[model samples]
Target: MPRLVIVFDEFAEFKGRHPEESKRLIGIARQGRSLGVHLILATQNIEAAVDPEILQNSTFRICLRVGQAQDSLQMIGIPDAVNLARGRAYFRAQARQQFQGAYCGGPHGKRGESVSPRGIIWVRRDGARREINLPGWADGRGHGEPEPPQYTEAQAIVERIQQAARYLRIRRPALVWPDPLPPRLHLPEILARHFQGGWDGARWSVCRPLRAQARQIAEIQPLIGMCDDPARQQQVLLQLDPERGGHNLLMFGSAGTGKSTLLRTLVSAIAHTRSPDSAHIYVLDFGGSSALKPLESFPHVGAVVTRFEDERVVRLIRFIQDEVSRRDALLRREAVDNYRDLNARRAPSERLPAIFLIIDGFGEFKRLAPAELVRSVGALLGGGVAVGLHVIVSANLQADVPNAIFANIGLRLTFSQADQSEYFRIVGRPSEARLRQDIESPPPPGRGLLRGTPPLEFQAALPSRGDSDEEQATQLSLAAQAMSAAWKGPRPPKIRALPFLVTPTAMVEAAQSVAQTDRADLLVPLGLDFDTLTPLAVDLAEDGPGFLVAGTGPQSGKTTLLRTWVLGLGAQPSHDRLHFLFLDFHTRTLAAFRRLPHQNAYVGSAAGLDKALAALDEEVARRKAQLESMYEAADGDFDSGQVIRGWPHIMVVV
Candidate 1:
């Protein structure tokens, strides 16, 4: 459906160097007319370079100049080319004609000055002068003399064409061979290109309309990088739209191929375009913490976990799983098909931000994490996209990824692999011959091929304006700080970690407000729970018959637990309502609580234990007698319960 024109200059040299390609060109010249393909070849020695079949198939021929008449005759069946002046040629299609070709170079006067026919005289020793004439010494008025032009007509024509194109809002074609991508593409430059406003010295101020549109569009699609589309002869913005393209993205390449750099670029772009309320990012840096560590300062970044922090990693994974479930439930309740629909229907304040989970070193994670966690991650991928949970992972090799996870990935970006085999294995064989050649060539860092209908080669943008690692890190830090300063909205909810040490007063202050004051007496706050990070307590009235504090080794919090229980009860304002009998044998840990009003008895030795037990037995007997008399007073009706009033709750510790 499309027409292509192939031009070959100096056909003789081209044919001599590439015989196979010359033959293929001959074949195309014979049958390419029907395929909408045309060829134009230029050469001084047409008799030797022009194939017989190709000459027979050629419907048009043009001869500019030749050294011999034979070449002129062979080109147009006429010897007129040999005598033609510069820039003059003979054309032959159905008939022979003479014309002058347009000159694209500088003024012809500069070119003809060296060949001018002005006569010069050479003076001899005897003072006699001899005149000599240069070659082609005919008068300037001859029939086939060279002429000079005032200006370059070709340049004028090109300028006019460019002006017209600009007026019509048409882009010019890209160069056949573009220059290599620069080492650094600054974040500000990229942001300026994609966004529609300039920086006001402090922060970027995007146009209100454009900003609104970007926020709305960024909900489903976000720009990732700049793509060079050689086939289309243009550069375009690369965006990953889950609605149109794939939900998950996979990037694989050898080390130092800019996979990590590209990951950071994605986060920076999202931070600039979408607010913290609309999108959030969580990074799991299995490769190293340096790549994504700077992003933690961004308001949109909820957490950045490294490989060494196993507890944090597990917590991040669990958080993602819980978020997925929550969004899935929200979708079901609202009768929405996906996150986009829910966002469209819900109010802005109630909308859930999309979560992007970036895994830097997926291979190492798969190997180090437990299989159950790995499976949980795989399950998250299955339906995470529909609920606004997207996974962007990078690996060293395709084999390291599981098929289940790989199947969910829609968009794949591949950087320079170790070998051609590895490249083909990741993106499959490229359909274009030029693409094959390009991939075979060694590429620089950040150079990658994005797989699609026609695979696109792109240079990933760097966040820094400088090349060094420190400069890049500094740039990221500054960008994050700027974004944070510009944002005035509510920050993302942080994932809290349990405190290492908590105090009784802090626990009591953290206790939930209850209607009954005695409920506080029955509940003793110990520490915070892991899942909710809320106060964890023991219900004294409900959790019976008693409590046992056990540990694996000495100083494993057994004594600490008992002391906390004793102190927590003593610190409560209603301390007199509860009683305690301490039997601390090895450690006098509970001795500090001996002065409290709640202390019924404090026994520190084995002999004291007997006294404490006797005291407990006597109190129990008194309670039993009191209950028996109450039963008798109730006419032996045991169901009619009656008990002594003002009896305190007694707790024992050993």
Candidate 2:
């Protein structure tokens, strides 16, 4: 749509008298660019005709044919543009938009110098446009554009400095300036605004090429050969932002490409950020123990390992679904929706470290006898991310899995795999195609091609040999033991748990050893609970027989329970008074007895519990006495005599 149009309106009133008509023509040419127009006013007038403003904006000006070189100086100064052939005009140093056609050195300009006349321009996209106006050499480093009245003065001086520096490579001693400043510091922030330009040996140089590309913001700190070299390791890493939103990245490389290693370092940097609401990365280690196995003991890791439990798994699924629902609701409610906000609004229930689930060997998920894992993958794709859930599923597929999975798994990392087709499916096509066949040839131990965006935006230091797996394990085990020991402190003479969660104030610790005399005053009926005693209790809340017991606590009626721990179901006259027990220590010196309304009674003891012969001994003795009594009396039913048999005895202690 940018077409060339020249306005000769001011020159229309061509008066030979040379009144003020010339001045008007120059003004129209100078201001036209601001209004989206460019003017080339060709005139054969003197100083009285041209306006200063009009001439200042003229990036190019020339004379078709003038009286003398002096007259040409008015248009181009120093070397008169009019001296050249009629159509072979030379370039003139001018400011502003419009250019008067003139022949120079190169195809665009001269061999030594190239002038864009109207600053410089660059395209962002297919058909986008932008003009660059940079400040001093180090835009906004030391000196910046002044405001209002001072702004005009600053603009003129800056351009003069630029031209002087360009034309004369050495600082122009010819044109002495009242002011001088040091070189500017270069940064992305300084380049986005105004710019500075100068004439170099054969051409002018402008820092901002005005070439449109991606917008970037980085408050870069000084580094030892940092921007120049990215492969070098940096101790302190900071990520520079590209554009406004976060970049979804993909990583593709062979094994030992340091994908997991680099991801760890990046995670460390993110943890050190001062931004309160920054979104954190959730690493999903789907590569067995090798991928995220090391993360099992790391703090701040939301590591989840799969276990075999049909019901428990269902519950976990429900929990994941609920988490997704909650995050979706939060997104809808918040005015400023971003990962940062959702992170801040995390509910107390969601405060279990982070909610990241590192599902190892995702392929194995389908192999397990589960129903429709592929369908479940859909939910994982939809709301898994926003809820602070990140998944790093590993597959040998060259390209990414499916569009849906690929979309959700914005960040991709590929370990070494032979199949290019699979890699293409796992990652994108470009990366897979490039590294597919190459991976099969056996890359160097710790080297491979890299794809996807660079995180940590830097490199991580290699660990020394001293940090080997066995050494690390030993250190960790020692530390855990030390911590546990410290918590336990000195051992008590007796470990005593009470009948309830509360440790009874009545309880006292003994110094040395407490014998049987120590428990002489122990009550007949007592309660055994968590605090005073490490009583094993079943969790009514959980299905199956899940019982927990810790160290010893206060002893109570454990012996009583051990005594009558067995009986046939429904054979007992009293079930409420009965219990079950496994004989270990402390099940001696006690007899349990339960009597019915009749004089006959049911009795059990630790000694009798171990034998069917003992039950037979007691029953046989009673039956023998009953038989003798029946003979002494007459005929009678089995009571304390005859063969009195109700049910067989089941021994629990045995």
Candidate number achieving the greatest lDDT relative to the actual structure: 1
Worst 10 residues of 2 by lDDT: 219-228
All candidates' lDDT scores? 0.74, 0.39
What's the CA RMSD of model 2 in angstroms?
A: 20.9
* Residue-level lDDT for 443 in candidate 1: 64
Off by over 4 Å in 1: 1-6, 9-38, 42-52, 59-187, 197-220, 229-234, 431-441, 464-472, 496-517, 628-646
Clashes of each: 0, 52
Tens digits of lDDT, candidate 1, 307-411: 877777788888888889888898899898888888878798888888888899889999998888878878988779789888899998888788887777878
Q: Locate the minimum summed-lDDT window of 10 residues in model 1.
A: 141-150
Clashing pairs in 1: none
What lDDT does model 2 reach?
0.39
Give the per-residue lDDT digits (tens) of candidate 2, residues 1-654: 343466553353343334465555456655665666676665556454455666667776645546677666676665445455555554444432223343332233322342323444665434378987544333222143322121233443465456545534544333222221111111222222322221111222323323443643221111100111233322221232222211333344444455544444333222222111222223434444454444333333323333343333344445556666776676677753544455456673332222433344444444552655445655665565554554445443434244555565544545455555544444345433235335446443223322333321222222211245465345433432332233322211221223233232222222112222212222111223333332222211122223223335546534434332221212335433323333332433432333222122232444634464565467658766866876678655435411332222222342
**Top TM-score model:** 1
